[model samples]
Target: MDLKSYFNQLTTKERELQFGRKAADPLRHAFDVKRVVHAGMNGEMVPPPLAQKTWQDLMHQKVQGHPTQMAYFHIPFCKTKCLYCGFFQNGTDQAAEDAYIKRLIREIEMDAALPRLSGAPIQAVFIGGGTPTSLSPENAGRLLSTIQNCLPLANDYELTLEGRIHDLVPEKMDVWFKNGVNRMSLGVQSFNTEVRRAVGRLDDREEVLRRLQTLSSYNQCSVVIDLMYGLPLQTQEVWQDDVKTLVDSGIDGADLYQLDVFEQSDLHVYIQKGKLPPAATTQEQSAMFSFGKNYLEAQGYKRLSYCHWARNNRERSLYNTQARCGTHLFPFGCGAGGHVDGLSTMLERRLPAYQAAIDQGRKPLMFLMRQSPYAPLAEVIMGQMNQSRLDLQKLIRMEPRLKGLEFLGSLWEEYGLWQDNGYLYQLTEAGQFWQVNMTQTLLESVEHLLGGSSQIHQKKVAAQG
Candidate 1:
């Protein structure tokens, strides 16, 4: 049960089995992780369970004093689809938007009325969507209004609205500001026209610059721009330019993403057609990652996570740290997911199915669900891993159930993962590398518990059957 040996045995087999079965079914790869996680939920074997204590704290308006924190909202509209987008979103008529909002309000009300929630102050309210700003500014205002009415918000609460460059016109910006939206995540994938066209995101760099300038003039919010590397036409030089733009623009934060070729995306078709460049080799991608990391660090931006960077640590997203745990939030509309401390729940992604559920006086709250006792433990580990930092003592205190993970303590001692200051636990640089593998370690542990393949001996088990 050595963690490293266990991972080697399990993952090596899983990969071999996956490659063997890739053409046979193409869909069952990683099905163990997928299926077991699902089956655990449906069978009610998932544990630690939902954070009732956290909710109770909220209901009593004591969340500010609690260590759990969360914020969530859903914008169910999109102007256009990106080739690689997997989240729920679709272009819809104004009527559909109106109907979605009505149901959304109901969902929010239900969450507010949940028995465990009485007066918990929300730490953050993140409104995300196909493109949240795609909704009419009026609708956006209305949605924020609903949230304010339903939840006790912290005075320094952070409200984030996901946006597209084209959507951030003066009028929209005005409405967003008035509605207490204090942060914006502009989805500007790339400024290069050719690359933008390749990915189906129509972002005008000059116009986007103008919008950012306008945003900078606002007093109430911080701005974060999203960037992606490894596009079809993107070269290392081009991506570097994009990174430079973020540094030069005075943006508060940046989320840098790597291109992932999903099986169902149009990019897959492009890959098949030989229209896209060969996928960035892992080595090349690592170089790009290092360049961005080093460059951003030199520019005085704090490296918040593997892919997230912030300026002076001022515009940090609450979700960036594991400072909070097991706080749940409700998402309304199509394809929105609701995650509580011990549970991972999502609504149906199909618009019609979700809408029909709404029309029937129900919120589409259960398309898929998983409640695990280990969720809080996983969150604590993963959250620290995200900051590329970990605190061992705080982690142990957060989940007393994990006190039995004594071997982990031994491993920490053996590996010197953290430096103990008698008061604080901080991850060493070597520990950061291990943090990147924590999820894999956790998953491999589950596989070992299930008595499955080890030593890179892969297996393919279909969930559908």
Candidate 2:
């Protein structure tokens, strides 16, 4: 049977039954796969546990002067629900939004009031969500005002806001620009109309280009456009044009996403019906990603991660590079995560639960992820995976827990996975092809160890539900 038929034959119950169980073995296998691939290329491997410990120590290190500099915010409101989106964003609710924003402001107040956050100048702040720009211009204004009032503002800091092409209209852009938002990331998933329809996004190419041009006119912020490949019917030809359109737009950066289908999304519904284009196989998606990387790099964009590329001279892009050293802060809404001086924390998620607690004057902290060695371990994994390159000595100096350099060296020799310049270690073609395995190894390793078998099953259920 074809992939669609194969997917269809598995009942939700059967799939759910196999969910986390299936991941455990494959995820474990991926590590060895990673080793073999790396070994083949003279890449490296370090035991994850050792890396985790080293990472945690890095996070808790309190040098006399430097402190936490990371912050994150979540705006859970969206103008419309896209079929392919899996983030925790909901359609707009004016009253609920008003309430949530007030709670968010309260949460920020609590964070600012914390002694740990007070003295440290924030190095980076990322405002993300369902669609932050979905807020009415008035609320957007208030939201900006709220952040300014609550945080210790850093003049040279990187401040990013998420927006859509339609939402980047003059009035909304004006509000965002006036408020010191130095960076804007537009959610322009695809320029192909049919592809947009296939994924339930609706920005026309002309409108997308025009809006980006308008954003370019703004002197206050750099612009980053988000593009997606691997939609139901997307071909490499189509995706290359999408990249060309983005390159032609003169934006500062681009985030190239491959379509990911969670069983809960409407995209899954189409998948079930075979009405949508078949999901691109991993091999196909990798090729598309390779195409994008080659095209963007040739156009003068620096690759920041597997999916993010930026012009060499952009400020926010520079901050991303600096953040690789673990100085970035992420203090935002529930579901948003980031690192600061190695510490990790999250605000809260359920709006009502979060708001109700904040209403009673409680800081809306769902949980503070204790600084553990795993924090930096995870960061290295994410950062390296995103950039697809590792500066071995630099990473070791940054966290010092990577005791497996020799092991990595062993794997590199055995598997032919990667090659080294004097300073940087980058993946070979085989290593590049196994990008998903690399990401899965890091993420799934954490998930399994932290939450174990039940948690995986629960996520599977959540995806299905």
Candidate 3:
């Protein structure tokens, strides 16, 4: 169907959501608000009654082809919980970690024996969680050895260990380097000592810089830090210094993140009680995003993704890049989630339950979901949008039905979101700020055009800032 024919089938409300309002500055005030922080399409939540047979028929005994693949190992224990965190599972205890690692290794061995993952070559391995860096040297060694031994790691695999600054000592760093951890992603939300303490970060500014420099002195791994823009005490000037610090720190790459405040959390309570300052409003965050993007580009740092930047070749960030574009990931450890063999699975979260499943010699499956029928196309769109450009020709080649989406390109251009540079639609500064909103609208438009679901109409609400 053509764009006009498709629009003719929808009501005004539906059109407004599917295509955004025609605003002068479509950057900050286009959408009512940003709905989801990490934006992407999802598949079926529950298996349809008839899908069981279809799943069985389509399921393969082995990985289908040489698709890029990765593995995610979750460490669910933290030495201390951050004030703003919602993912904290358990406090650190040596006895608890020892037991968990033993079971985790067992679970790894069991999955390695499965037909789907047995011989597949995983190109990237990410050990992430409450703090993978906080693991004792002994435990870290054992876990790393098991992963290197059991998994079919490719010759040039990138193994990233995520953690905090307090754990960046020589003791942990030595074991990490010895065991093939070539990438270290540390969270340094802000370098201001006052700001760090307000958010429950233990290290002071001096220690953070000293530890980062020490880690880089090893010269054996690529180091990256994460900086958040909308923290409770992170002012505009502070945000500038944080990014400045990232560039000056000589790290390989950085992630410029916007904070999401969850209601009913410790952070929220403290703010309500006047104990902490208010977080940056969404409008302010949009400006912060623009400044970060421009400053990094001016400094000659390459844009690896919408939120990620790289200063050199050492930091390709393979796992995150491939995972976003729909690479298969083998999941392990408590609370880990990954997708493989046409299904996504989340392992059990509770320690006792995870241990029991591992002991039973079965896959510790907490939830399993079949992907959406349009998953392949959705992956391409999301992956491209994240890099601030979309190829319309590729989209048309992927699915002729997507030809109707160019109506959106024409509309967004008028609103100052993107430009048509030959065959590619490149997003401008405004488009990058509102990329999530534009991405979702395009995905929803595609789904509606293809008759995937019924649309709900809303009375068009005028948005102005």
Worst 10 residues of 1 by lDDT: 34-43
lDDT per residue as tens, model 1, 1-465 = 543454345455554332111222222221222111111111132232333333333344433345444566777777788876766466857998888887777767766775344345667778887788888877878888878877768888888898788887878888888878888888888877778877777866787788788888886688888897766677889889988988888878988875555556666667777776555543344456667877988888887675778985568766544233345664556676666544455676777787776667555654334455455555565565566555556655765433434444445544455455565445544343233333344333433433342323221221112
Q: lDDT winner between 1 and 3, please give it.
A: 3
Candidate 3: tens digits of C-alpha lDDT, residues 1-465:
566677678787666555656776677666555555555555676454544343333333666777788999999999988887878999999999999999999988866766667667889999999788878999999999999999889999999999999998888889999999999999999999999999999999999999999999999999999998888878888898888888898889998887767665788778878899888877888878888888899999988888889999999988877877878888889999988756777888999999997887756777778777777887888899988999988988989888888888888888788999988999988888878777877776767777655443232111101
Each candidate structure's TM-score, on Cα atoms with residue i matched to residue i, is: 0.78, 0.76, 0.92
Better of 1 and 3 by TM-score: 3
Give the whole-model CA lDDT for all candidates, comma-separated: 0.61, 0.62, 0.82
Clashes of 2: 34
The true-versus-predicted C-alpha distance at residue 303 of model 1, in Å, is 2.4
Give me the candidate number with maximum lDDT: 3
Candidate 3 at residue 299, lDDT?
94
**Candidate 1: Cα lDDT at 445:** 44
- Cα lDDT for residue 157, candidate 2: 73
Across residues 244-308, which tens digit of lDDT does each residue of candidate 2 receive?
Answer: 88888777888887566566678878878878767665446667777887787788777775566
